[model samples]
Target: MKLLSAFAASLLWAIPAQGQTDPSQAALEAAAMLEQASIALTEADSARDRVRALTGTIQAYEAGLAAMREGLRKAATREAQLTAELRAREKDVAQLLGVLQTIETTAPPVLMLHPSGPLGAARTGMMLSEVTPGLNAKAEALAKDLQEVQTLRILQQNAADTLTQGLSGVQDARTRLSEAIADRTDLPRRFVEDPVRTAILISSTETLDGFASGLAEISEGEIAETDASISDRKGDISLPVQGILLHRAGETDAAGVTRPGLVLGTRPRALVASPTAATIRYRGPLLDLGNLVILEPQPGLLFVFSGLQEVYGEPGQVIPEGTPVGLMPGETPEIGAILSTTSDGTGTDRSETLYIEVRQDNSPVDPESWFRTDKDG
Candidate 1:
């Protein structure tokens, strides 16, 4: 019996622990996306449209980073739960180890012969037979948990390098994209911008409403009209950037100010695009608001985006849907900061805000009604 117990323990130790649950799917997907982004970066250098190519690369990096962060958060949470569970089961584990030690040390003849004679020995054998399975099962479960904990730790350790590469690749792509946009001169323009009129309008208008109302005054010539209309897609338009809605239209802010627009919380340097093909009516610093882009998707509908660090495209040029318009203001976080935020799961990495206001025929409308607020990207 002692030899049998020893053999069992040897077998348990020799066999690798098989986790009951699958590895994190999010982590796997994140790795795949990061790898693709790496490949895309290499291919972007030779692409015909460098701007579009770099844009795709940047998007891939963003998705990979987001997924990686989520995966790390889950791993951290799982590790904590397993640690707590193991601590709680300390007594059970100690008893299990004691039972194993006692079995290994006891003489087979003495273990078979109980104090009360043959009947006692038979009862003891029966009890051992029933309890042995439970012990083995508990040992297996413990092994699986330990293995998972080790795996999670290794994943987190290796994630730092992967995140660093992803962040660097994305920044490089953004720089290349900006240069490509600057060199771009093929886009068609509907009208020429009169800087003097624009300056005059800015000086004269106190509110956004007044500035928007006077946009036509800044046009040097007749604005070529297009039949472009997104009325069919009203109430279902995707947001121009990947972010969470921080404040709703007419909601009061910490500064005791309320506006008829939606504020989006986004990660640093997040890309802002046009949700639909539209004409750029204005693109510059507006009263109090930072760099802004005002797009007219249709004759009566205007989509205003504010709080950009750098604006793209000339005013009066019509850009297609998903065209890169601007980038949010802020610097990319360090790997340590990213990991800390991931472990905390507080979503504080979204440090930049983008203000979105939709106007219909010179009247401000609820941006939530026009945008799908449920989407994160």
Candidate 2:
């Protein structure tokens, strides 16, 4: 009788717990996840396109400045030659004036009082008429040279100002680009699993990939239906972060460990975003990776963004594309921790690195082949 009573008590506790799990609510959560993922993916692509366009503008400005410099060089040469010619002409005109003055004071009066009288004066009048026109022509040439030099100087100044303004604009665009990326924080959560399992998994995992794979299995939740899958957009997505591609999949690192993903070098405190919409499966620090976040865009596919200095969003959260998920470390040795272990000959000292991994069914794949560097390719 006592054994039967204990069995009934256990059944009662199990029934309510099972009843609390609602099927319709789970489906709704899944639908919202899918819709938000689609929107986030679109936003991610647009962000990349904007960055590309801004980079192109900066390049165009640089080219224009180069052309202007070349043109200015030629103009300056012309000005130099014109200035030298003007100086010579002025010297010749000065000598001509001295001679004309001597003739006016001495030759004119002498001609008027000469034995030949009026005939000599008539000859002097004709000479004076010819010299006066030559003097007027020299004055006009000098004025033209001065005007040309003044115009060249003005043009050079204007070009310098224009180039300065263009550089300032480029700097502003760069600042705005960083700001836009950092401001993308629109993640909403439906649930978050307990951290004990995550802590245990991190402790036992040998590799980050292995740690992420374990997370994939443990972080499974309600099914979400989307219009498209991440697999459907292969080679049509943007990189999650804005920076130079420093390493590709299968590349060995400085420590001789080979990882199967792309590495990007980004600025300090740079905000990292998702390349596509996804549900946060894991967000925390690991052994080597200081702070990390894992995203489940679909059931089998997982994106591990390691090397974060700070993280936002929780597991089971649905994040839109281009949403700011975390921040890069601004200070070193923490900053140094995020830098690329492998150099593809493209990394610099001013930037830190973001390690990205894409896993499908627990297998790593090359992200470079998946991300679209250009809109078409």
Candidate 3:
């Protein structure tokens, strides 16, 4: 797109004779922009795929941990049951022993006084002794079983401890995978700037669908407009936008949907990325957000969406449906105002503008998805 000189070129009051430049040039530029956007789209899609795989791995670990937890629960329940039963049996054994002792001691005394009698206390004592062996054996067996239960409790504890450790490890791995996939957001930005050369970049995007596929309540970012930057690696790709939210989950009201978002950076130039590929980690308050968030996007990258003036506020690109990302760097008083529809056939309507960012983990990503496919491409 031809940028107007900051100071409108001084007008020469001469009559024009040559034909006005054809609109074809603009179309050509648009075509080029579309081509570059396509490449970015492909990269974003691939990154998403990798993230999904990592997420699945994490889920598997969680499942394993859940199973282990269930086992521990069962073991604990069994131990409790065994202990209750053992206590009951011990009480019975104690009562029986006390009665047998009383009888043996008293009966012997009575028989000893009549030592000469044929049916003497000595004979009775022998009978009691015969039964005592079996009684003692029964008590001993119960005691042994009780001790076994104690041993089982200890064993179960050990198993539970081991499983807990394993579960923690799986969780750590899952976190790493999630962070890795998120970091890919930066790839498209870098690829777009140099397409064939650059290794790292930070840019903006809009216009493409599923670009924020996994995000919650995502909306389109800035739109393509005459005054906007409308930059393209090759040509013109323009599409305006309005507010968008990733992880599009939130409460809706008559005004609009209040989706959840992490409003990063009250500080200018800090709104590098949203939750998709980037995040904020702060040990101290982010001034307005109150808490610091550390976000790991993956591939050894960490993004912190901090310096936020507010934490529970909103974020992402803004513009009419076709607004270009990062094109209108300044404020637009015509936020909700209508503009002529650029599509095939539609009446002019209204729209707003929004900024957009893509980050892999905590770094920024190029935002080219928010533009139209150039007619030529």
**Best-matching candidate per TM-score:** 1
Q: What's the TM-score of every candidate structure? A: 0.89, 0.47, 0.27
Error of 2 at 35 (Å): 34
Tens-digit per-residue lDDT, 1-377, candidate 3: 01111111211112224574322233233333333433333343355454444333433433343333334344455556667765755645565556546555775556344445656556555655555565555556555556656665665545534444443444454344434533544221111112211111111323122222222222133212222222232123231222223222143434474423222111111111222332221122322323333332333332333222222211221212211011112222121111111211121111222222334433344333322333210
Candidate 3 segments whose C-alpha is farther than 4 A from its true place: 1-49, 91-155, 185-377
Q: Spell out the clash pairs found in candidate 2.
A: 40-321, 184-324
Better of 1 and 2 by lDDT: 1
Candidate 2 lDDT over 1-377, as tens digits, reads 23323322322211113444232233234333333433433343356454334333433433343334335555565566677766765645465445445545775465445356688667656755655555445446555667868776665555444445444543454454555434544545545575676677877898876786676445446434444377778888887665666677888877787788877776555557777888888888877877888887777788888888877666777876765567677642221222212112233533678898888888888776678754310
Ordered from best to worst lDDT, the candidate numbers read: 1, 2, 3
Candidate lDDT values, in order: 0.85, 0.59, 0.33
Top candidate (lDDT):
1
Q: TM-score ranking from best to worst?
A: 1, 2, 3
> Candidate 3: lDDT of 226?
25
Lowest-sum lDDT 10-residue window in model 3: 1-10
Candidate 2 residues lying further than 4 Å off, grouped into runs, are 1-190, 216-228, 331-350, 374-377
Cα deviation of 238, candidate 2, in Å:
0.9
- Estimate the lDDT of model 2: 0.59
